[model samples]
Target chain A: MNLVLHNFFRSSASVRVRAALNLKGLAYEHVSYVLRKKEHRAEAFLELNPQGLVPALQLEDGTILNQSLAIIDYLDGQHPEPALLPESALDRAWVRGLAHAVSCDIHPLNNLRVLQYLDQQLGVSEEGVAEWFRHWVDEGFASLEKQLASDARRGRFCYGDTPGLADICLFAQVANNRRFDVDMSPYPTLQAIHDHCLELPAIVDALPEHHPHAN
Target chain B: MNLVLHNFFRSSASVRVRAALNLKGLAYEHVSYVLRKKEHRAEAFLELNPQGLVPALQLEDGTILNQSLAIIDYLDGQHPEPALLPESALDRAWVRGLAHAVSCDIHPLNNLRVLQYLDQQLGVSEEGVAEWFRHWVDEGFASLEKQLASDARRGRFCYGDTPGLADICLFAQVANNRRFDVDMSPYPTLQAIHDHCLELPAIVDALPEHHPHAN
Candidate 1:
């Protein structure tokens, strides 16, 4: 199965899909886009994904899957060797809820584009932009830490034992949090899970620093 | 199923879940919280959902589901008759991608909390707040209109003749957009889909004004 991942090295969303693909043992090539350079906004890339977002996976059949979670879902469906979600519907909901807490509630607010808007458009100072970043992360990670620390379902990863969708999202977000100096001491559960994720080669290889086009 | 939905009347995320429940013919009790009053931050509500965000569905066994899309996905899995997601993996990817375009890309940035942050913390004026809302809607809608209009899979709704996940999110967001006076002229495809959604009682009854706690 040939796959081409259109992504930037430091995109948390890209990190998610890359980790998922590696976890599934699916080999894929990278088509790097320098998001800061607006390469993602180029006409050719726009044709691939009109959303102009990175982490689009192009299937061998020319189908492009956008949205990191959606792409991960599709890959899970098509592969299913190491499942990304749990078996039961209720469990899947739990896992998905954990994932969205990061993706929807935090990452979207702190992503490069939103930060750029806060700085360039809203005239927020650099310190203010960093504050904005830490703000969302703190809000999200606080609850996530409480949820994970209390839930008996949480094992070495977000769920029982194996790394799944929630773990993928958590790992990526924790990595992104470092850039903003987000205080992980407040989130021991999340910090531990992120540490556990770091031990896996599949997850480690997906890190931005390990990306082929890392600056 | 003895479902209790803790949500605000006008939250777009709440609207999405409400429409999904209505579409699936699931009966759930409303537990309203006025977000502007910080009612969601109440200790009781925090016990239910540590995240303290609304649209949490409490099941019979007392398991609570948070995140609107996650709750919708759970409902779809439990009640498969009126499926929210498409059957095929690739098709499901397309539908989810469209849904996330609204939920993750647009809704999160334009939600009450973010707008409040922009206004209170950053001192963005009323018009600036409105501009911020419209900017994201336009950025997301422009690409979404392109994707939906160009794709052969699009029908009366975002995916096919039937209203599904994408339609639920799109409809809810368009409703939210009305508050900011977003001009819909640029997104004819989305506008048409939103129009189609309005014709359904399931969708119409889920509107904020129709909620039991609407002020």
Candidate 2:
């Protein structure tokens, strides 16, 4: 089966899918989009996803899948070994909730478009925009750290000792946080889980610097 | 099983849960909180969910599930008679993508707390806040309406003929939109789906006015 991942290296959503694909032992071709250069907004990429978002996956049947969570779930369903989600439905919900806490709540607020809009339209100073970006992210991470540290459900990873869905999302987002110089001292459990995830080869390869767009 | 839902009537998330419970024909006791009065932020409620969000479900074991999506999924898993998700994983992903498009993307931006922050802290005027709310909602709904209208996957509902997870989310958010006077003319497919969903008895019972806080 041929899989094409259309992504930018710095995009956390793309990174999540890459890690998921790597974890499943899947081979795919990478097509880079330079988001900073407005390449994703180009007519070519817009045809692939009308929303003009990155991390669009082209399947063997040529059906393009948008949304990182949806794409990861699609891959997980087709390739179950080294499963990204937990076995039980309840466990799955918990892991998904953790993932959403970052993907849904935190990431969107600090995304590239939003940051650009803040600078270009809102007249916010660069420092102000950076502070605004870090604010929402730290709030999310603080809650996540509390949940992970206190919840009995956590293991070496975000779920079981295995690197499951939540671990994949957390690892990628934490990497994004570090780029912004967001303080990690407030989230010890998150740091520990991230450390565990980095030991895996799949996650290591999905690092931002590894992608062609990172330059 | 005795099902009790702790929620506020004005909360869109609570409305979704109420609709789901009604769809499943489960008799649930409503434990309402006055969100505007700082009741949800009280120690008692915060103990249930540190996030202090509405729509926390009290299961038979007194286990509290906080996130609205997690609560809804738990209900679907526990009571599978009238399933909220589709049978195939691909269809399930589609349904979830639509749901998150509203819940994660639009709702969070225009949430009460966030809006309040814009007004109280940032000193944004009432008109400015409303404009901000409408901008994101319209941006999200435009894409969603196009997707639902063009895709063959859509039947009378967001996915097929059944009123499933995505429909529940759409119905609630559209109802909230009315309060902000967000124009629906731009998204006819979304408007049609909203109208169709409201036609159901479950949806009617879940309207914000029925909640304890709606006085």
Candidate 3:
């Protein structure tokens, strides 16, 4: 099976998928699409992903899948090694809750197009856009920190010392947050988890800097 | 097995999970936390879900799981009858893509806190907040319409005739859009799917008006 990951270097969503694939010990080809150049929005790319989003997985069968969360969930289902989810229902829910807090809540607000929309259509100034980005990140991280702080299951990683789906989602977004200069100090637990995930070989290899599109 | 669903009537996330539970032919207990009254933000609820969000499911073993997506996935995993996902990897991805179009992209932007943030902090007028809500919803539906139009697999539902995860999600959010007064004329495919899902006995029973908090 020829698995091709269509992604951009700096896309947090793409980075998360890469981390998941690597952590699962899956070997796949990488196809970089420079999002800044509007490559994802081109007609051919849109044919692959009507949403014109990055981190689309093109299977050997030529089927394309979009949406980072769904793509990762499918990957976890297909490859159970170093299982991304916890063994029990409650634990699985907590891990998934952490992942969604970042994916559905925080990252969605700071998505490239969202920022562009804020600036261009909403007439938000540059500073205003930055504020908008940071505001959401802070709100999400605050709750995430609270959730992680008191949990007995949290180890060196987001869940029980293993780099699960929540860790993948959180690490990528934390990297993005740093790029936007959002403070990590408020969320000590998240910062600790992010630091730990970055040290793992799979995550390090999947870093945005390793991508072809990276400068 | 006693399954308790903690939810808010108008919350799209809660509605999606409720629809799924009902579809699975499961007998569950309903627990209401009124969002408008800020009951979810109270200390006890916060302990259950630090995110202070609706749709936390308590399993038979007395385990609590938060996040609508995760809870629904757990339900599907436990009760495999009338499976929610397609048989193949690609097909599953497509169904999940449809779910994300609403859960990840459109719904997050118009979430209750976000609208409140726009008004209280960003100083957006009520009219401006409504416009922002409608804009993102339209953007997502436009993309979804194109995908649905191009696919022959779409039956009376979002995916292959079954009222699955995607259908449950889209049905709930479309209902929310109506409450927000967002126009739905542009996306005929979405409207069609929404109409079909509402006819299902489970979805009809899961209607927001059926909840205790509904006005």
Candidate 4:
């Protein structure tokens, strides 16, 4: 099946899809969008994703699927090698719950659109925006720290030894923490997971810096 | 299998789980948390869900799982009948994409905690908060309307005639839109689905007014 990915270099959501593709050993054409320039808002891109979000997948049949988790799940469903989720349904749900802890609860607040709203529309100061950014990172990280440090299922990654969905999100969140200068001294388990994932080729190539349009 | 649902009566996320349970014909013990009264923040609740969020499901073995979508996926997996997700992998991904469009995009920023943070911490006025509320609701509703209205697979619910995960999320969002007084005239398709869902016993029983805690 032909696959094309429309993504922003620095988007946390896009990073997950990139990592998923790399992990699954699926090859795809990469299309970069310079979000600051409003390239994603162009009519063509909107036709692909009405939500105007990045990390949309265009399948061989011209069916476009948006939302990074959904796109990753699709890829995982289509190509199950090095499976992204656990075998048992209960275990998969637990992993997804962990992923959502980061993606649903944390990332949405820090999305480019949300930050832009805070700045351009709410007239928040740069410092205020930075504080806002750090605030959410800290809140989510604290809860995650407690969850992961306590969970017996955690190994080298957020789940087992292999890197998967939750680890991808944890990796991205760690990057965001570094970008925003949020304190990492509090989350040792997360730090270990982040470090473990960075050692992998799939995750390493998917970092924002590896993207063609970084900065 | 034993099941226990820990939830807030009015939470959209919790409402999704409630609707899912009702649809799946799962007879589980109902454990309510008074979110406004800080009942969810208690130590026991935190033990169940480290994040202090509600709609956690306790399994027969006493293992608790969090996140509404993950819980639904778990339920659907355990009880195959009345499947929450479609049969084909691609169809499932599309359904998941629709669900995330509501759960991850529209609901997160409008969550009770986020709203409280905006009002108490950021000092956003009531009107400002309502504007913030409507802004996200409109952004998500516009895209969803475009998606559902354009899809040839449109039926009685978000997917087909079945009231599944996406419809549960859509149901909660429609309720939220009404609670916030967001204009409904613009999203005719959503209004129609909302009306369709209200006719179903499962969805009707899951509405906030029918909950044990609603004022």
Candidate 5:
């Protein structure tokens, strides 16, 4: 079956799916959309994804899957050699809980669209937006720091030794955090896991700079 | 095995998990946390969940599962009689995509903490918060309406004849929308599904007023 990934470089959500594909060693044709240019807003693109968002996975039969976590889970289910979710249901929930802490609790608040809304609609200043972004990152990371530090299952990665869905999500968010200059001193475990994820050759290839649209 | 749910009556996220538990016909002792009073922030509560979020499942084995979707998924896995997710890989992704659209895109922006941050930190007027809340609900619902309308799989529920994760999430968010007077005219399909879901005895029993804390 053929696979196509319509994505935008430097988008944390898109980076997440890319990391999953890389981890599973799945090859797909990458079609880039430049979000800043409103390329994602084009009628044709919106037809593919009504949300007018990136990181849509188009299957060979033309089924389009939206939402990074959903797409990642789909991929893991289809190819289970290196499972992204844990073996036990409870352990899987624990790992996914951490991933949601990043994706839902932290990233959405600081996403590019939300920041743009704050600036254009609410007239928030650059400093104000930065503070807002940092506020959420700090709050989420504080809980993550404590949870990971306390979790008996914590390994070199967010779960076991392998970098699973949690690690992929955390890695992507950390990249976005660095872009906004958010302080990372408070999350040593996060930093270490992110570093370990980056050490993987496949994950390195999925970094934003390595994407075709990064130029 | 004994089951206990720690939840908040009015939290949309918590409501999502409660709806899931109700769907599985699982019996659990309920422990309610009042967010307005900062009861969830107490030292004892925070120990169970570092994130200090409501709707954490404290298992009979004393394992705590955090995040609404994660907890719901764990229950679905353990029970498996009535699946929250579909059997086919692709179908499961579609349902999850709809679920994420609510849990990630819409609800997080209108959540209590975010609204409180706007009021306390950014000095946004209550009117401003209402507008902000309605804005996201409109944006998210517009796309979701388009999606469910366009897809051939539309049934009595978001997926099929039975209510599942997507329906549970939509029902909770629609309840929140009504609370804030967010106009629901634009989403007839969503409204219809929500109305159908409320027709179910278990689902109706899980509504906010049924909780002991609602008085």
Candidate 6:
């Protein structure tokens, strides 16, 4: 199945979809949009996705799938070999809870647009923006560390032995954390899981530095 | 199957889960937490969910499910009679995309914690906090209005005639919007869908006012 990923190199959400596609061993082309240049907000891109968000996967049949988690879910359904979620309903919920802890709780507050808003609209200093970024990460990662460290179900990844949805989100968020110098000492479990994810070629290939448009 | 919901009455996330449970006809007990009083952040509540977020669903088997969408997905999987998502993978993606548009994009930014951070931490005044809230709601609703208005699959609800995931999220968001006085005039489609959701006993019963501990 042909898929074209419309994304930016630095977007954590984009990192998620790219890693999911690579994990599933699905070949897809990249249509890079430089978000800082307002390329994603262009009329043509907006026509494709009303949300105008990065990491919109245009399927072979031209259906534009938005929302990173939703796109990942679709990929998991269409290609189930390397399952992104576990088997049981409860297990899936467990994985999803981990994923949302990053996606909904952390990344939403620290994404580029929100930071830009903090810098421009709120007149926050550069240091203040960095502080805001680290604050949310610390809030999220502290609990994530506690949860992962305490859970018996956790293996090398957030779920079982394999990397799945939670791992994808955790990997992306940790990678993004580096930009703001978020101290990782508090989240040993999260750091270890992130380190394990880095060993996988699929995940490493999806990192920001590995992207074709990365500066 | 005994189930208990740990939640706050006015939380948009809690409202989503309550509506989902009602839609699935699943009976669950409500354990209220006043977010303003830092009740959800209490040691006892944090022990149940390390993330310390409300709207956690505890099953009879003692499995606690966090994240409103994940909890809803779990309910949909276990009780598939009134399915929250469509059958096909692509259709499910569309529904999920709409749901995430609210859950991930809109609600995450405007939730109680984020607003408090803006008010107390950033020192954004009352008017500024309200503007900040409306800013995100408008940004999300504009694209949502465009997408829903242009989609043919939309019916009385966000999907077909049934109240599904998208409608649950949209309903809760619109309900929350009333407190901030968001102008619904710009989103006719969303306003109409929310109005339809209000007519449903399942959805209506999930409103904050119906909660036993509601102020």
Q: What's the DockQ for every one of the candidates?
A: 0.91, 0.53, 0.71, 0.81, 0.90, 0.90
Question: Tens-digit lDDT track for model 3 on A89-131?
Answer: 7678788989999889899999998898778766888898889
The value of fnat for model 6 is 0.84
- Model 4, A1-215: lDDT tens digits are 67988998888899899899999988888888988889998999888888788889999998899888988888888889999899988889989999999999999999888999889878888888888888888888888899999888899988889988899988887776666778788888888899899899988899999987677
lDDT (C-alpha) at residue B42 in model 1: 94
Q: Specify the CAPRI tier of model 4.
A: high
* Model 1 misplacement above 4 A: none
- The positional error of residue B23 in candidate 6, measured at the CA in angstroms, is 0.9
Q: Give the C-alpha lDDT of model 2.
A: 0.83
What is the full ranking by DockQ, best candidate first? 1, 6, 5, 4, 3, 2
Which candidate number would show the highest lDDT if scored against the true structure? 1
Q: What is the TM-score of each candidate against the true structure?
A: 0.99, 0.94, 0.94, 0.97, 0.98, 0.99
Q: DockQ: which is higher, 3 or 5?
A: 5
- iRMSD values, candidates in order: 0.5, 1.8, 1.4, 1.0, 0.6, 0.5
Q: What are the clashing pairs of model 1?
A: none
Off by over 4 Å in 2: none
**Which segments of candidate 5 are over 4 A away from where they belong?**
none
Model 1 whole-model lDDT (C-alpha atoms): 0.94
TM-score of 6: 0.99
List, residue by residue over B60-134, the lDDT tens digit for candidate 2: 777677668877887898899689999997788778878878887788777787777667756678897888788
- Fnat value of model 1: 0.86
Q: Candidate 6's error at A6, in angstroms?
A: 0.2
Worst 10 residues of 3 chain A by lDDT: A204-213
TM-score for chain A of every candidate model? 0.98, 0.97, 0.96, 0.96, 0.97, 0.98
Give the alpha carbon lDDT tens digit for every residue of B1-215 in model 6: 58999999999999999999998898999899999899999999899999999889999988899999999998999899899999999999999999999988989899888999999888999998999899999999999999999899999988989999999999999989988999999999999999999899999999999987799
Per-residue alpha-carbon lDDT of model 1 for A15-45, expressed as tens digits?
A: 9999999999999999999988999999999
For B46-139, candidate 1 gives per-residue lDDT tens digits of 9999989988999988889999999999999899978899999999999999999888999999989999999999999999999999999999
The Cα error of candidate 2 at residue A83, in Å, is 1.8
> A1-215 in candidate 2: lDDT tens per residue?
58999999989889999999999999899889988888987887877776677888888887788888888888888899988888787778778778877876788777787778667756668887778778888878877887788889788998878898788888888888775788888889999999999899999889898875578
lDDT of 2 at A14: 90
The TM-score of chain B in candidate 5 is 0.97
